[model samples]
Target: MLLNDRVCVITGAASARGIGKATARLFATYGARIAVLDLDAGQAEEAARDIGPGHIGLACNVTDRAACDRAAEEIVARLGRIDVLVNNAGITQPLKIMEIAPENYDAVTDVNLRGTLYMSQAVIPGMRGQGSGAIVCMSSVSAQRGGGIFGGPHYSAAKGGVLGLAKAMARELGPDGIRVNSVTPGLIQTDITGGKLTPELKVEIAKGIPLGRLGVADDVAKACLFLASDLSAYITGAVIDVNGGMLI
Candidate 1:
């Protein structure tokens, strides 16, 4: 077990078909105690229960600093220590530049960028004390290629900020033995894309992808498992691409 006896927290993990939930299940299977944090308290707890025993679920709005702090403290109090954190809580909107109102931009950027910062801030103190930890922030291919099928300019901007933020955090946190990294995932078949794409559109998209298929939630989850585990111990300040050659 790569994460034997470790405690892990994943944000926005309540959705049944989301990447965060997949990551929680994978980590649990690897012997890690998982905590599923989401905006809905009931859903969070339910998701945790679904994952298995000895895991927890909590309500956390990551854009709120106090909420992030409280959730972090609660997890530590319940689980003993936090060895890994996956900042997977995020939201996106598909709007053109002109369609991006202040509210839309705020909704997208606050959840994706501000949430990542707040959650990381909340976890760093505990990690510093332990002198060993890992944080994986979820960026998007939209950030790299400038736009995506579903995310707008604002979403791309937010994820671009994630890449930079993770790198900077990795540099500063390395001295404390806390590794930080980002994962840039391409178009994955999740609730979001499922709602946005037709079967015919998905086929067309797959043709454009070198792997000839859209990524699945498990594909991104496994990449995150690598970064959170000792297999990538020497890696930090790096961005792992889970795009299945779409960007190459």
Candidate 2:
């Protein structure tokens, strides 16, 4: 019961096989009331229901500051408190630098970088008032290594921005009793990577990893669980890499 009696909000959790949903499930298993936020209200609620009883799902376009504010308010109103927030709403593009149009850059950065900012902004006031909270922003191995197995340069830039933003937020929010951290997961097997790898390709990729396997969504979710719990109370402005030695 690491998160017993906690209330947590996770963005982009509607995707059944995604990291956000995995985190939601893990948090729920620990006795935290969970809110699954997604662009699609129905899907979000469905995901919540799948997590079990007493969880909620809401529609939130994290790119829109107003929407984020409203969603945060609704969650607090419904759940009474917010103990943790996971800014997991993000989008990635696999285009090369030469192929990145202005629109592509906007689409990539808006969801990954701006979304993290706006959502965290919406939740901070609540956390500040409570004087205790944890924020886990999702970064990527692409951000660290300058490229990825699939994501484009813009994706790297967006996730890299997330890392910087989380650190800054952690420094500023720590005094208020809020801890902020980022997770840089490597080549995770999720909807994002589904159908993109052949069995041979996966084996080749695994050879490069010390753990010899692509990361599962649960691997990252378990990391989020630790950060969201009191176990990480003293940690802030940290980047926990869940890459299984891909970056090493």
Alpha-carbon runs more than 4 Å astray in model 1 = none
| Whole-model lDDT, model 2 | 0.95
Residue pairs in collision within model 1: none
Estimated TM-score per prediction? 0.99, 0.99
Cα lDDT computed for each candidate against the true fold: 0.96, 0.95
lDDT by residue for model 1 over 95-214, one digit each (tens)?
Answer: 899999999999999999999999999999999999999999999999999999999999999999999999999999999999999999999988877788899998999999999999
Which candidate tops lDDT?
Answer: 1
Superposed on all Cα atoms, model 1 deviates from the true structure by an RMSD in Å of 0.5
